[model samples]
Target: MGLLPLFTSMLLFSWTTLNAALKITKVDLSIEPSAAVYRDTNVALRCKAEVLTFGTEALNRVYTIYKGDSVIYNKTTSSSEDLLYHLPQARVSNNGKYKCKISIMGEEKASEAATLTVEGMSTPILRFNKANITEGESVTATCLALGETGSLLFSFYDNSKEVENARVTSNELTFVPKGVGNHIIHCSYLVFVMPNSFKSQTSNTVTLTVEELSIEPVLKISPQDNVYEGDTVNITCSVSNVTKDYQAGELLLSQDTELLKSGKTSIHVNWTAHARTPMLTIKCRLYLRDVVKVVNKTISVSELFSVPTLKISALEVFQEDEISLTCRIAAKGIKKKSKVLTIHPKVPVSTPKIWVSGSAILGRKVEIFCLSDTGTPPITYTLWKANKQNQIAIVHEFNKAANFTIVINEPGRLNHYLCKASNGNRTPEQSDKLQTAVIEPMTEAYLMVVPDVDDISEGHTVILICSFLGTPPVTVRWLRDSDDLNPLKTTTTNINTTSYEFVVNKEHTDNYYCQAENRANSVESNKINLVVGMAMWKKLLIPGTIILVVSSLVMVGFILFTRSRRGKRERAAELSVKPASPKSDDSLTVTLTHDTEVYNAATDAASFCDDKEGRVTNGTRGSVASLPADISNRSSYSIPATV
Candidate 1:
């Protein structure tokens, strides 16, 4: 019985172990059409797996396909038959290394890699939208790569030079040709894939003829016959071919460079005839994009009256003299008549006078005046600068005077000015140059000493120089210690520098400055302190006296120190007393006495020693005896004598 149970347990364990061992083996991948095919061809990929399962129930199998390193398709099913993955309209992007994998339970297997290549693209066909083309017009071009797929780049060339490129699926582009000539055009395409791309051959060439615009402008005149002066004339300009098929452009009617009228299609103008010129040329212009068409016509104008003749009673006449004059005129088909009158002759204007008023300083406004004398009632005056062809200003006045206001910006620029006058005479008379001057404000003033202060000694000659930058006629003044009331020297000069020379002395050892003034402004120079040195002989005498006094003091100190050493030795053998110790509440008293007349000196020495050590406590008292007369008045303490 025990052996039967043991056998049953062993059988159960063996069956369980066999059911868990599910695996996949022998995986094969294949492509339907050949390994290499053209683009847009339908393709199929087959993945087959041989699975070994010991269980009664079916095991789930997973199928995965790869292109390069990316998974393209995956599926899970309970079937063991071969599976298929279809690619509709395969393109160049599908050309790469492909693989398949099968998985059952925990065990899987992969098949070897297979390569698919898509090659060969159709030659591109090129065509234009119209048979004939015109300048300034656009044309549509179509390019086709019949069997190609994926992204494509189409290029259009004109005479072997690329003009346009488009990346589109419809493959159509519009462009305009350059100039008026026959152009040879062709097109090509590029097939773009992930790992590889292919370019097709050029298309058949087509010749395109571009012609000029066919619109012509027409010009017409109303009075085609002999036209007379003071008559109104009409002009018309038109374009016959301006229709819906053409673009709208500008139309202009002009005489020479002057435009009389402007419109979209046609223009009209009314002008009065003049006898100044015998013949006049009128033009009509059609303006399109980068193209212009012109038409012109000429007309003649006749004079309506002849030139007048005048006769005077006297040839030589002065001002305020009366004279008789006769005026006559004759014309074709008109009567001639004469009229007598008495009038004064016209007088020409004299040369104009020019002057300036107001301050002529920089950055200030000033007025320039111009006047002409002994001229007609109305006269024209003009102002000009020397050597300049253009006039600065002009004015017409019955009083024969004019003025121009301007700000002066440059110094000494008023000399370049003149004026002219005219009253319908042969030529204008001019005035002389202007005589105005410009003043510039002082910017800086500097004062300097010829010999520096350090080098100056008694009886040395020193010079004080004042320099400045400003207009002429400047006043310079030298002051002592910045005191204007006590000026040492003052002068006016046209030059830039002025100076003063004097001998150095005790009175010269003081601060000095200078001031410069002009019509515009005044400025002061920097202050300078003068320190005169002593004479050489006096400097030597002062050191000699100091050395003699120091020698006498040294000898006295040596003699006194020797005597003090001897006295200290004698006092070393004298008896001394030691004081007793006291309690905290009791006071300690110390007395020092000297017997000589120098007792005040001993008291001073003891006080110095006490300061060096520390302050005495409140419970302690110190005293000196036998003070001197001067010392006793100040204090009573003195040192006592020792036996």
Candidate 2:
């Protein structure tokens, strides 16, 4: 058993020693090489050995071993410290598998393998799942191995081919795509091994698709084209593959201001938006599309024009001169330049030219001469006018003195005058207007009379009044209220000086007036009414006619006298029928009594009858008082009795 333990111990020692002896102690190279070598160039190789002193203090010491007369390197020779080998040139031949032996100072130590492999370059595999990748987006790339241990260095490159860091790792690498282009991306690396001591592992060349910012977003708008002055404009920014979050920068409109976006790619641009009330242009600007910074566009509108300033000047003027008038307007905008223009006429005047003169008159030949001038050109103006019957005197031809009468006709009405002016080619500028009254008397006629009123009495005399107005000496006739009175109505024209007498009677009480009517215009004098009132009695009837009244009165008196005479004769007859009794003389007995007595002619007549006839008793004169009559018997019928 003890032997077994001892033998096991020896065996363990041997195994441990062999294992330690075989261990790779040091792997190193002399004459360091640059990381990159151009194609087809000479490159040198150097190697040193130092694995021989693993268990001792001489662990860092290095040397070489000799083999035959060829002077080859070994563990013991100092030449092994720096063994140099110069290759002919860099080529396929230059590509390599290089080797070196490692040893400690005394014992032949561990031997290991390394490589110097010329990577016959081929471009890496360039591939991208997407051609475009937006910024801030996550992505990954896989480098497929062309050969060897299958590990590589990861690198990033900008569109300019600028190299980024080379980081070594196994399998795929992750990154955020930073820019846009045909991105050429591949990886390079080294392998740990022999003659071809190191192996460069390359990936298949690939293109990484990275997204870039757009130039200007295809500006999407709700109202595609025109927005009114007062309206709002809305624009939306979008990158086909990007979310609104990335486009959430600003939309610059018209360069005036900037606006921030939220989750929305669109924003409302508010404005008062007044466009063409007077015709104008408007613009809008938008920001942050791609590498490009801004954008712009325009809009338009139209407005209205109003009536301008106007009025009149002077009232009246003399003949053979100019009439002063003016027209005015409110000044507006940038004061305008002059233009060519023409004028319209007043009261139907033909070719009424404008002149500088300010005043014009009525009848004497007037002049209106035009002259060229500068300044705000006045609107054209017609000749001054007033009233329907043109009172302005006229001239057919402008005198050589430029004296032209504008008023060929007359007007009898009030009028409005204007100066219609323009800058030969543009809208006009008018001045304050002038008004003038036109009056003429030469072309007219009227009525006149010499003795307007003459000769008259209270229902008796004659009076005549006369007057006239006319172009020429016109004759006049005296008319009583539009009527031609008969010759019997007036005296013969024996009087001179157009004076005539008129008889005033009760019949002429109405209008004893005279009208002296002439051809031109007529005139009449006021009426003369006559009052006829004369003496109360004598004047009423002719004196001779009153004599006839007296004659008729005399006739009536004679008839009454004759009637009284005839009546007296009849009475006398009656009285004679009785005879007087006796003529009692001297002293007739008289008796006065209370009751007076009446004399009885009957008794006397009875006595007279008795005496004539012899009286008998029975016949008693048909009664003695009855009486007989000698006159009665003559047959005058019977007289009425009153006695």
Candidate 3:
């Protein structure tokens, strides 16, 4: 191929433009495998000249090859055609500029220069995405070229041996480890150069360590202590070992045998505790294939709140009284704590009850009380007196108590009275009216004798009368001087009067009075005196003297009758001696004379004591006799007879 430049000039041109006498033709140059070539490879080059020339032809032609102006080959040929140059086993030193030249007899022509290139070797690197992992875990290995290459195929190797079916279209390879150990890994790539294929150098080795998988389950609950009833609790169960081989329902959370939530490696659940009865057991379970791990916790909730009870002290309460009250809660199996409080209850006003308890005498104080019932504190009491016109007037008032007192300064002040009470809440209450005249005992009384005169005779009965003026009926009592008399002798004749009937004597000559009394007051009547004289025996002596004078007159009359009878007899005898003369012969025997006396006596002894008069008469002698009236004794004279 080095003589191709002289053969191309002999086949076509016989002319040269530089020397006009000797003409040369134009030529061109080219090389096969025009792209860059690999080290220790082959390459070829060609040169041609124009076919026609318009100049004198040359008998002899020469061809030569040059490298950057230094000739390497020279040949002489008599034919005219194209020339060829061949470079076998090309190296980095053969890479440079090349050209071919032609000479006809003494004229020469040159072709254009052509260039050649040769590439050097490149290194490959091996790397992995993970250094250590558990068995059943996946890993990726990558191989990269430092220089540019086309149409590459990557293959992985383990332990200096090619892995079966471990080819990949990309520079990376992914696989799962079946066993646990430290394994060396690398990759190699094949590149197709122009006309053939070449394999690159093996990449740097890397080691992967695989171990057994182990993890523990953990349980956590929010608000670990002092939990109350009816509160929501959050429970979380988790595990640290997570991989692509993890299946659903690996971790579970439950409360008291009831499942709440399930997840892969971790789970969460919310539970509401029961009211006042919270004793729950929480459990967390982790299932790794056939192996199981579990954890548990217990929670206890406290009780609820209650209202307090109140208790007060003191048996009875009064107005403006201070008291204490204590409050506490009665909880079972709990400590007791008490709180104290102070209170003051109010007192209300009511009707006033009044009582008069003093004498009705002038210049005396009377007490009245107004009653207070259940009400507020600080009661007011007012006392009122009613006059003759039935009008009331305030006499005494008490601010803090329900009592009042008043002085009776005059006798006319004994009238009606009233009492009122109040506590400033509403209208005041009043008691019923009470009259002093009706409640007071009888007063201003007087004692009257039946004759209303003082002097009286002794050994005789006299009448003593008592009378008084008061509102209520009064009981009268009789007294001798200042002492009380015997009630048997002094008897009550009426509601307000008593009579004392007894034989008057020297002991009854003292002053006597009558007393009148009632519930309110007592009074005494005016004193009365009686006088008795000594004329009792003189009245008896006068009746005795009259009865003696009447008895003496009867005795003297009998004496005078006797004397007259005797004188009559003497006259009769003298007449008898002289009667015998004349007309007396036949009747002389019947002419006799006699004297008769008459006496009258009283019937009762009282008339027998009176003075009497006596008469004497003699019918036979015609003579009358009279008795002396002053006869003192009837037994001192007897009847005198005449014979």
Candidate 4:
């Protein structure tokens, strides 16, 4: 039993040792061309494993390659050689973390991760079919990425703004730009690989210049000389520089706003000139898709003929007289035309009546009108002074009535003036003579005092005559000094002379003037002073009475002287005793009466009579009172009664 237990123990120990020795030891992963490389380059990944086994024969090995956490490659082989994962023409998909794991007989080992990088792409090249083109024309642009493989997206840019994008297999794109002026254009491409995409740098820039279209239309007119009415003209319109490179276009010809013709490149039309439309404007237009060109021209048209006149056959016409009128035109270097009108027994003018517009005043103009009730037009009128041969004025008028103006140089001569009317007749029609009453304005006036103003006396009749050289009816007024409102007398008469009579009195003594007024004017005569004197009878009686009174005083004084002488002797003794006392009878006192009437004279010589008589009377009274008593009484003195 002891020997059997020892044998089991030894067998158990050998089995344990065999099981421990059959485990995998190490794993390693590596890549060929491990540094960064460009896209589309070939790359290889290899995985290595170390195992501890007692057999000398090969074992079945399972290999797996991992990108990130997913298995990308797997293989089962019965060899110990290292395992490899090969990428042909590697792309962006081949650029990530890679790890290798090996499994042999239920034993597995994994390697540390390694990365594969693919870098860079080829730069694009940009090209254009045309660098300079017109605004409406297009340019073809091409983008090329040489030695590049993948699906690519091409983007085109003008300045910095993207214009177009295209996805294509071939590395080419066509681009068209907008607007005019200089443009900078470039292109870039994006390469699409399995899970990622790559972009290439922009290509070289190209400059493009765009310009405006230069196509101008032309217009022409036939018969280039002066154009006249009723003449036909041909007009043509065309354009230049219209080549086969552009699409078919249209051409139009027009006048003002009316279209005349339309065609492909040119057009022709015929038109007639008219007098109403003297000026014309022609226009030609060329039209393409979005472009137009235009041209314009102007023309003038002139007129053909002239105007007409008329004439008469005779200067005077009468009743039952034949007359003729002709219409003619004088066309220089052209056709002459004429027409005649005749009338047998033509109507004669009625007697023409004449009158004046206003009163014919001297030194002023007057208008006279003459009219015929029946007469043809184109009548001639003549004004005569004394007879038919003496013509004052002649007026030719187209109407039946005519007028004339004349100054009234002599109003009396106006009565013989007459007017005559004629219309191609042998004898003119005569009117009744004009009886023009003229108004002569007052020019001179005279105021005369009748009965000799110097001999005027009180209670005598005086006459004031107002005479003027003017036509009547004239108003005559008598004024004293400046008081004209209350005239002493007023009268209106047909004659130029008038008179006013008054009994001379003191109230009538003042400055007197007469105003004579006619229709034309009023005039004042020279002023005269009127005075009243004493009556002629009083002049004779005053001096005679004075003489008689002086004679009577002489007689009384002589009588008184005798009586006093006798009384003186008787009363001598009494007189000597009484010492000469004053007594009423002793001195003979006399009283004389004087005339106090005053007279106003017309002349200075007659004004001193009243004062001379007063002085003489005063001297006589003084002489009488101063004489001695006896001598005073003996003087012959007689006192006359107051006259």
Candidate 5:
């Protein structure tokens, strides 16, 4: 067992020494150029294996290269030699983890894996012409990829976000950014002819800053035109979109380059506009660190807010008068405007006027107008009779300058009308009452004189009344002896009668009559015959006295003659007788008759009938006692002479 143990120890010793000699002391993995290689370029990878000591014999050594977990190349080398893997031209597919393996003297050792990457082109560079610029200003950026032979796909990014891509090796882009911010600009490129394809490595970042500029100061004015004196005008100079923090600057209000007001904020300038400054050109100015903004405005001052003028077409107004009124206003900075108004003027106030258009006779339609002269328009008329409250007829019509017409169907006496007018602008107005009279129809006229006695005494005052009966208002005329009498002697007493008074005389003792005339007809009164003479007592007394005188004289003469005859007959008596027979031619006869008051003596002869020439002759006278028998048979009467 001891011998076996010794032999085993020797074998273990040789194995231990051999194991120590084959163990790798150092293993190194590297790539030529020590950095990333471009596409289609030659690249070499080296792996070195070192041991504690070298073996003299022809050592059995093998070298192997691995990419990731797969072997790419295998070879044999001595213990003192280094391993190299060459790629004639690197491709994009040659990128990955790389490792080397070595085996010598029947022992193997491995190295840790290293990484290699192949790109299509070199890294691009980004450059900006200006680091900071105002907004709306142009900026240029350049992208360059060195050692790039073919076309390159270059992409630009702002803030790690891709903005644009172009297929050019060297590119310059000019643009204006609207926003204001810190912009980081970088470029990435890919080689079109390289084996590897993808987004390339990014370039170095360049910052491009854009800021917003302040706007020009704008001048603002209130009450643009027609500005009055003692009015406040507001002016403001303001800047917009300021990029940096700024304080309120001086805002200037200037007129014709002379500063009127200046303040850090908006200002109100109270300016009195007069003839000196009828027109003004004002400016507003704002100031920054080294920048200024100015704005100008023009203003004109004139009259404003004036009272409107009133014009009337007429001063005096009557009924049915058309009137017009105009109101005109003239203002500054505005067009002139006017208003025209139409008016219907009213008449003066008084009682209502009433008139009948036609005759007011019975059974006739009469038109009555009740007019009120005071109201505006649209008068209503109503007709009524006396002692009645009810209306006869109503007229309602709208006429601004017309009267109301009321029609009566059958007009009668004591008819009254009333009128009312209202324009809805004032109180209702009324008119006075109107009464009507009866109308007369034409008729035949008749006239007469009073005191129908035909006798008129002289030197007597008599009233000759000429009375006429006809329609009222008959004219009376007096006529004497078929001639017109003077009007001074004729007096009218009433509408239908007249009177005349005069002293009766010889010239006035003529026939008088009256003629009455009207519109219908005319007629004359009956004639009155007047006689003027002496009194009846005086005329009869004179005639009676004359007749008495004549009768007395005759009686006295007869008596005296009788007395004288008696005296003469006593002195001488003589008788002469003539006897006559009955048949004889000459005879004396006598006859006597009874007494009568009146007697005629033309044929009487008798005896003892005393005649005026009786003579008594006794002796010679024959008695006439014998008469004719018939005459003697008559009654005999004694003759009483007498006294």
Candidate 6:
């Protein structure tokens, strides 16, 4: 029982303690929450602490929670720290140190303590994502943080005066200040501890940046002065630049309480803003990193971009022409801004589209274009031509310059030419007619006559030869002297060729002429002169007359001999015929010869007797009446006697 026994016991105890300590290091004391609940309402609290090592006796730890001289909770646990605990209820009377103690080797070690002030209701942490309140109307602000479960006195104070108050049981508290001023808030615990009651602490001081109720923030956009549809703009929307844009929205940039644009080389905004505005007002506040209200600025969004002006230009152009055209367009706009140019949907400009007339002759061209003042790729152009026939747009050029040369072909054709250009949305520029002209071609008509006279007989024909030159086929109106020949004898020329033989005659002796005519009612070369030499007049008649005279002489001699014998026979025959005196009527009969000449004559029969009816009476050698004979009589006169 003396020294030896005591030493053995001490050794055993020491070994036990060492074993426990080693095991404790391996013990996982993992906390469940990511952060601490620094404040609380009611304080009926309980926590768990247990030994997990099997080599050691399983034991529970005791816990104590406190706040400002007040004990909030005290409890003993038999389960692991992972275990959950439930108290009958939270009470304002329960508040204090939040700590846990465990027994080991007969020594006490405590867990970290958490103070719980059972104020039941504390002045809420009037916290706002934003610190400064901009000028304008009173604002309702929410204050939030981990707190006790009992009712919380949500309050706002101006220094020491109460500005607002609310009852809250949730983790959050809200308060609204009536005006601008410095404010302080204090929360006193409602719970009492063995040695002391709950203490109160004042909250962080706050100064409301209040100025006035903000009129509904006016809104505006940059370049609002004038704008084109489908154009890109550096757009913004804001209550004020200092209050919202680069200052507030751009990484909390502010001076004192005044909101200012961030100095970042690049601009970034939590939200868009309109910097270009007229009379459009908004509230702005100067600020400090810790949220101090300085000044609120009212600013307007400025017009950063202007409506684009489209300029369309052309050097030359003419009307009534058909040819290619070129047009030029120009425009200006903000950088990094996009703009579109819609050419005159139609190829030509909308205005008197300065263009070459479809009927224009060659040597001239026209141009048309559209331009933008502000925007990317702000110019557009087109070229086109109308034909001489006045047919529209037979050709066109796009996005190019405008210029055209029209080749006129039609006569007296009027060309109404025009051009247009445009920025996708802006009005287009127009050009005037630069030139005008007309064109016509040459035309002609005539008749070709080829005539041949192959026959030239006494009663037959004479060849008449002739021909002509000109356009189209022409009719030959054959003419003999002043007489118009029948078409049957005339020939229609074949294109440029013609030929025909007309009967030759003395009638053709004079000038022979042929006139040609065309569908245009046009006349050609006057009657061509033709000399028709008459062969009939030169050959048969004159020579044949001589032969006729000789024959007649021989015929007269033979007739005399036969006449002597015929007289005796004629007398005997007459006696047998009951010889009667020659009747004067019979002797008065006229005999006609087959000649081109005719004659009528009467001679007195003095020796003839007449009856009462004017009939001639029989008488020896009675006188007779006869037709006048040819002046060149060819016979010898003789008289016959009657019995």
Clashes (N, CA, C under 3 Å) per candidate: 8, 110, 26, 15, 4, 105
Of the candidates numbered 1 and 5, which has the greater lDDT value?
1
Task: Give the range where candidate 4 is weakest over 10 consecutive residues by summed lDDT.
Answer: 618-627
Best by lDDT: 1
lDDT of 6 by residue, 144-240 (tens): 4333443344444555775444434342444454445433443222223545544334555545554443322222334443444334334222334
Query: Whole-model Cα lDDT per candidate?
Result: 0.75, 0.40, 0.62, 0.73, 0.61, 0.40
Error of 2 at 208 (Å): 66
Per-residue alpha-carbon lDDT of model 5 for 1-643, expressed as tens digits? 6999999999999877876765667788888875488787788888887766545555657888998788989987654667778976676557777899887766778888887877764577888889998755678888886655445566777787776443444577776654678888887876553344555678999888877556656677777787764456665555555445556666777888678888765666756553236687888887643445678988886645544666787765666667676776654544444444455565443445666665464433556665555544444444445434344333334332333343444434534555544444445455556567654432333334334445445566666666665445666667777456463244334365567767766676667777766543567777777666554665688999999999999999999987865654443232223444332233343335433333333433334344334443433343322222233233553322211
Q: How close is each model in CA RMSD to the real structure?
A: 26.8, 62.1, 77.3, 56.5, 70.4, 53.5
Who wins the TM-score comparison?
Answer: 1
Cα lDDT tens digits, model 4, 401-489, are 57787777775537778898876644888888888788889888898898887888889899998888898889988999957679999
For model 3, how does the per-residue alpha-carbon lDDT over 1-643 read when each residue is reduced to its tens digit? 5589888876555334424554566877777776368865667767666534444554455778887777877878766766777777655445567788887656677888877665654557988899998756678888896553456778888777787667776888888654568878888887654345567677788898987656778899997677765567888999866666655438888877789998877787777664334577888998764456789998886654444556778744556667777676754444334444445564556666666555454455666555555445456666776622222233222333454666666555444677766666568777777555324345578888864444466777777787776544566677776456563243333365656666676666767787776655667888887665444665676777778777787778888887766665454334422222333122222122123222222232113223322211232222112223322122232232111
Off by over 4 Å in 6: 1-466, 473-476, 479-494, 518-549, 561-643
- Selected candidate, larger TM-score, 3 vs 4: 4
Cα lDDT over the full model 3: 0.62
State the lDDT of candidate 1 residue by residue for 1-643, as single tens digits. 6999989999988756754676665898998887788777888998988877775777778899998888989999987779999877776667788999987755789999989887666788989888578876778889977866667888888898988554445678887887788889888987766566778899988888889888888888989678987677999998877678777788899876777899888888788776657788889988777667889998888878755667888864446768776777765554434454445566777788888876587777778888877766456667776667434444444554677776778887688878788767459888888889998888889999989989888788989999999887999989987466868988999999999899987667888888999888889999888888876667787998788788878878988877766565445223222236544465433333445343344666466435543333555533222222333223223322221
lDDT of each residue in 70-149, candidate 2, tens digit only = 22343334333455555433433234334555544234432233333344533345445555566445556654434333
Which one wins by TM-score: 3 or 5? 3
TM-score of each: 0.35, 0.22, 0.28, 0.32, 0.26, 0.20
TM-score leaderboard ranking: 1, 4, 3, 5, 2, 6
Candidate 2, position 123, lDDT: 38
Q: Report the Cα lDDT for candidate 2.
A: 0.40
